[model samples]
Target chain A: MKINNLFVWLKQKPRIAFFMCLPLILMVACLIIYPFFYSIFLATLNKAETKFVGLANFLFLFKRETFWLVVQQSIFFALVAVFFKALIGFIAAHSINELPSKGQRKWRGMLLIPWVIPPALSTLGWWWLFEPTYSALNWLLEKLSVDAIPWLSETFWARFSIILVNIWVGAPFFLIMYLAALKSIPEDLYEAASIDGANYWQKLFFITLPMMKNIISITILFSIIVTFANFDIVRVLTRGGPIDTTHLFATYAFRVGIESGDIPLGAAVSLFMFPVLAVLSFIILRNVRKRTNEV
Target chain B: MADVEIKDLHKIFDRTEAVRGIDLSIKDKEFVILVGPSGCGKSTVLRMIAGLEEVTEGDIYIGDKLVNDIPPKDRDIAMVFQSYALYPHMTVFENMSFGLRLRKFSKEDIKKRVEEAAKVLGISELLKRRPRQLSGGQRQRVAMGRAIVRNPKVFLFDEPLSNLDAKMRGQMRIEIKRVHQHLKTTTIYVTHDQVEAMTLADRVVVMKDGKIEQIGTPDEIYNFPRTGFVAGFIGSPAMNFIPGNIVKNKNGYSVFINKQISFYLDKEKEKKLEGLDGKDVLLGIRPEHINEKKSEDAIEYDVKIDLVEPLGMETMVYFTINKVQLCGRVSPENNLMSNNKATLNFNKNKFHIIDPKTDKVI
Candidate 1:
């Protein structure tokens, strides 16, 4: 009787359940399942022809020397850029939070300016400053009696320029996240710490850092996924130039499929970014869920 | 525990003067309670003593050392906040030992002190639990336990029992009093609840508008409030104030209320009313001062009982005198019924008179 009554009540709320699930069901068919199987089908066969070339795309992916070099470059760029971004962002957030309430709003607004501007527009400015001729940075170095170094034409410098631009574009994200986490902490905890004879350094280590562990982990995870899969800043600033020293997975996919017209190889290279992003996403989501349970 | 002395302490917050220049000396092992209405700066005074607030002027001495420039941690004072402020992430043991750990005490020493405090507070079983896992009364006990573990020079409490329910508040009130009695720390507690102040404080400092209104023992405050505000504020259901004129009647001197109810005064009280016989004076009388079953033995007045508050042991009868509502406690066995007229007598010797202009006791 109880089960029948529950089913009757459920029938009464059919519209609510339907409205809630409409978008998700449609997205599963249109965006997720359809593209997933279709991408696998495209990756297995060679260009427009449905010839079963079993493992050729995977074997050819490893045989290409440029693919391995791009893999190393992407790892180097993402890890270095993420490290600097998270460190600088945490420091900037601490400074902003320490400001008086009235001044804090102005400083936060200024810090968000870089994050608010379009990444492509900002990268265009960086591209202009590192232009081979009439370069502003090289011109300034020459005036200071230093050699006019080729910023974009050199392998290491080109990679370094792209990583720097990524940091500039991404640090504000971490800054905002850390600031939110800092504000969520109650002021009473610090008061209690001070009353416990904890100096500033002791309080930061024992209270602030431990309390911010969840947020710090989630922010770094997000930075990893975004930096690894990033395309705009690298494509605009360096175009994976200087003998492919700065080529990341996203740009490599673009180069092989759009620039070089090797669709199957491009699909294989693009699919390589999935595992790194999936692992990072899983770790971040798990940490976030654990924190929610703790709270 | 040590004595605390504040001399001409003044604190100004922007345009408002929070704690005006005031001097007070609390003796060793004294439990002084600062009691006042909200925004009357009682908490500010307690915070100033805790070194949580900067003194804008004057000096504060904790056991003869001028601690005006000392930070809260170095002042050797522990505070139990109204919200308890227990570290939510730390267990009760950790919360109690945090200060000791920061001062770099030995691990065993911290454990011993925490255990001793938990035993004193009767919370030994709750040491491993975080604050969120504890009940409200338990959290209050943890907060007190944290303070007791420190054994500071003085203890500061900011309305620590306000968050508990009424019955729990009463129980915690007694527990706090017992803790104070055992520890004998020179504690400064702040609360807006006058009942708590009356029951818990060895001496109550009644404040208003950032200034001390009166400082005296609970009996002295209840029996001899120096001002009208103190008299009105210190008592539950408060003392009744009736506007009347002291007149020279045919028999002797008396206070006339309405055209009836002339309360005759004795010679000593009449002499005290010498020059003010015809002046406008307000009479203050406590609820318990009036008796319902009147006789010729005391001065009597006929009143129509408007309402009755039966409190099991006694009953409070509400009546009116000269358009002012007055309440008086009578024995529960009096068979008092609302809307019935009865003769009630005032204990003339205990009557208080205030100057209408200054509201000061005369």
Candidate 2:
């Protein structure tokens, strides 16, 4: 009888709604919540999983020079790549917006090709172009009477190449996002601005950019997170070569934990990204919420 | 302020002709209204004049300069949009000062102009607030203040009061009229509301299907519509049109509405419609022109009231004449009942005779 009553209660509106979402809740628990806590647990364990060393792995990582280098490289890579991506994407979006409607559709579809291609496969294509000896870029340089670049050999060139490839892949995301944001602005605003005696540059500064501020901030924040945690591009292109100078947090964590067979140390290195990302997300989300409330 | 002249202006969007060769010369400091139904190219014509749209094949002159190739920023016009397109991120002061600042005005001048415009629009208290913080009516006032601060050669209003509620629309209409009187800038306003056109315009240009149906004063458009389309478009509850044939009798001419009802033409109407005898035509009379009081110069007919709408000041009586629905406006004191027979009289002087083929006044 109690079981029957429980079933009846479950059939109520709110309970039924909760039950309908039960699958998604459990899926999230297994996929996201479980792995997050499990990583923390693994970070506390010592090598071989026989002993618990509280904060030792973190302290050891902090003492290492390579860990500091990885942190600096990760922050620099994310900031520079995301900045270039956003700039180029905004310019491209404006260009596309200027085209006639039929032409805009054609250009939008063509510009999204870099994004639609799988990152790893396209990164291999970029690797071939950046190959030290038989590089296509070198051939073009020879044709132009310019010196051949040591694209993936030297440390600086390797970092530049990785950032360039990241921008090539990521700029389309910003372009698409900014295009949607641009389209959402009412056309009458531009008309009013023009009739009020605003030139092209004035309209861009006063109308387009101000209206797109919220979306731009949110897109940059999301791209920062994605670019900071990026692994596939670096792994496929540089593999943290040239004395580990281009090693980001993800690549360095993989080298330390999976490749070097020190799971606790690797987990600790990966876990270091949490505080930085959490702070960034908190600040950006607060800004977004404030803007939304104003609107 | 400067006069604007548009000569044979045409806009062809792909295959569809949005504006089919319109020519208009607006006097300096005059308020001209372009009013029509939606998709009638009234807004298109306004945009073309503002330089927001490229003129396909025409010459536009503002003052003495030809502006067909000039960009909108160089056109020296200020426009208030229907959406009140205030910059969402900027404060009201910033929104109003944006145009002046772009024109390289001094800081003190920008501040003075914005403050003055805001005071004129009665939105001085909202100067520091962002557009999102203001109500709809406040935002509309900010939009007007933005235009007022520019002090351009002409002011264009594209249905500026449409987004407001009814009461606010009525109030804003008066405010707009007052602004026009105070500034005396040559203005071109566009709207689909006939009442707005009648109330605000020194000259009302009524358009239909991308062509000007009639351009006249409000009184002329109301009393002497040149076309059937203009007659039907300009009046409230619309002027009732009944298809009929003019019959020439021994004494004079009368219109046979059907077997039951016939209306004799007055001397002036008969002189105007003499050539169209024995031809099918449309007889139009405004709802307000029909009355319950008996008169010597009115045609009396007994009509069965189908519906009665009491609107406090006046009541509308709806009935069918020759199977065509017709409405007559009567004073509320008449207290007419529905589904009952009543004697009605249509003012003979106010009746319109329209040629059926051309849809033009006979």
Candidate 3:
């Protein structure tokens, strides 16, 4: 009788569609929402977990030089890597777009190999390539009548190595996305631009770039968020080494929270990323919304 | 504006020959329309003339300059696409001025040209609005404004009015003619609509299956079509074809449609069909050429009316004679009834004799 009543209720009210989505809502709450507030609660606790410290952990991180260094490095790492990734990806996508259709499939498959491989496994291979004594790049340098240079031993080189590897792995995502955006544009726009007496660079600036602005902005925002919280490459390649100069928020939080057993301090360091990300996302999303409405 | 000459032009995509050896010449400041069915390669010919498509086996001459190897940007052509193809991000002013700015025009010159074109198109108030904010007709004007600001040597339109409603299409057709009169640019318009072809084209080039079927003025194409395809394609309610055999008569020749119907040809038509006697031919008669009232010299045939459609201006009468369905235009005052016998007069002087083997008018 209750089953019959429930079926009748489902038939009468379309609002029951909300009930059908309840399981997914509950799962998200348990997995994502619960951990989010729990991390904030953990960030406010003392070391011993007996009483709330009331921003003490955040105050402590603000006073540390290493913390400030990590902050600066994190911003620099995300900005530089994302910029190069977007640039190389855009150029590669245009090159692929210009190739004959038969040749494009082969090039696209080869370029996407780095993105398809597991990040942890690929970073390990990069780590081996940057090894101090047996690096392949250094060996090549030696054969070219140049001295063997340290790849991971020095501060600047280690930072460069990690940023280079980040670009290598992340660039394929941008390539695929930009390629899809390029394909979505109608063919007639280019033909129209050509008939308008536009050169190649003019077509790129006036037609191609303006058409791709929305996708570019959203892709950059997403890549920024992912790159800022990145931990696997730094963890596998340098492990926040070379005097901890390459430590990002994720690695620094791991170093403080898990390695040093200061969970509250680690939570506090990771929580700092949220506000920055929130502001960036809010600005980008608002711009995207405005652009969408304009169109 | 300059004249365009296409010599033995062809375009091949893989194995499919899209355009097969088309040769055409346009006089300076002439408005030519390429009209055909969907796969007839009219658009392909336009694109080749614009240098957007590579000519596989011929040369294109714009103002006596061989332009087969020239890129589209150097061809000094402007095309208004069917979709308008406006830069969605730019205001109407920017869209119109994009080409001039690309050529490194000074700011004052760019503004002058864009404003002049916009004012001519009567879109001055819409310069600040984006394309998506405008109506379809407004967007179409902006596209034309973009093309006009460059003042290119040649103007190409690829079914630009196919996207608009019937009312707007009629309105824009006059505007396009007016623009051509004012600018006097060598314009080439392509469309599949015969009405648009008739109303707008100074001369029409009819195409069929990668080849030019006929090219003539609109009046000649409507009245004296060179091929049966053009005769059938250019008219509303379409010209009807009735299979018949030309038989030699004592005095002249008569077309024997069936045992129940036959008509004698006049002196001029008989001379034209002198040697073609006893050959199978198809009679082409437009719907308007078959009338309801019988005249003194009109040949009358009895037919069973199948349907009667009242279209306010005239009524269309549908009937079948010898298993061939045909439409005839009649005055609504007749009050024709369906499923009844009615005699329709055939305007013998307006008939066409088509040789069925070659689908050509003889």
Clashes of each: 0, 0, 0
Predicted model with the maximum TM-score: 3
TM-score of chain A of each: 0.90, 0.94, 0.94
lDDT of 1 by residue, B48-92 (tens): 888778999999999989999998899999999998888877899
DockQ by candidate, in order: 0.62, 0.80, 0.80
Give me the displacement of residue A258 in model 3, in angstroms.
1.5
Write one digit per residue (lDDT tens) for candidate 3, span A192-249.
8887777788889888998898889889998999999999999998889988988999
lDDT of 2 by residue, B1-362 (tens): 99999899899998999999898999999999999999999999988888888899988999999999988889888888898988888899999998888889999999999989988999999998998888888998998899899898988899988899999999999999999999999999999999999999999999999889999999999999999999999989999998899998886888888766676766666777777789899999999888797787777889999999999999999999888999999999988999989999888778788997899887
- Over the stretch A195-255, how does candidate 2's per-residue lDDT look in tens digits? 7777788889889998899889999999999999999999999889888999999999999
* TM-score winner between candidates 1 and 2: 2
Cα lDDT listed for each candidate: 0.88, 0.91, 0.91
For model 1, how does the per-residue alpha-carbon lDDT over A1-295 read when each residue is reduced to its tens digit?
9999877766767766986898998999899778766667777878654586767887898998998999998888888999999999999999999998899999999888888999999899888899889899989999999998788889978887888888888999999999998998888678767777888898888788877888888889888998999999878977888778889999999998779887776777888888888898999888989988977
Local error of candidate 2 at A283, Å? 2.5
Off by over 4 Å in 1: A1-15, A24-29, A47-49, A139-149, B248-254, B264-277, B293-297
User: In model 2, which runs have C-alpha deviations exceeding 4 angstroms?
Assistant: A1-3, A12-54, A143-145, A291-295, B249-252, B258-275
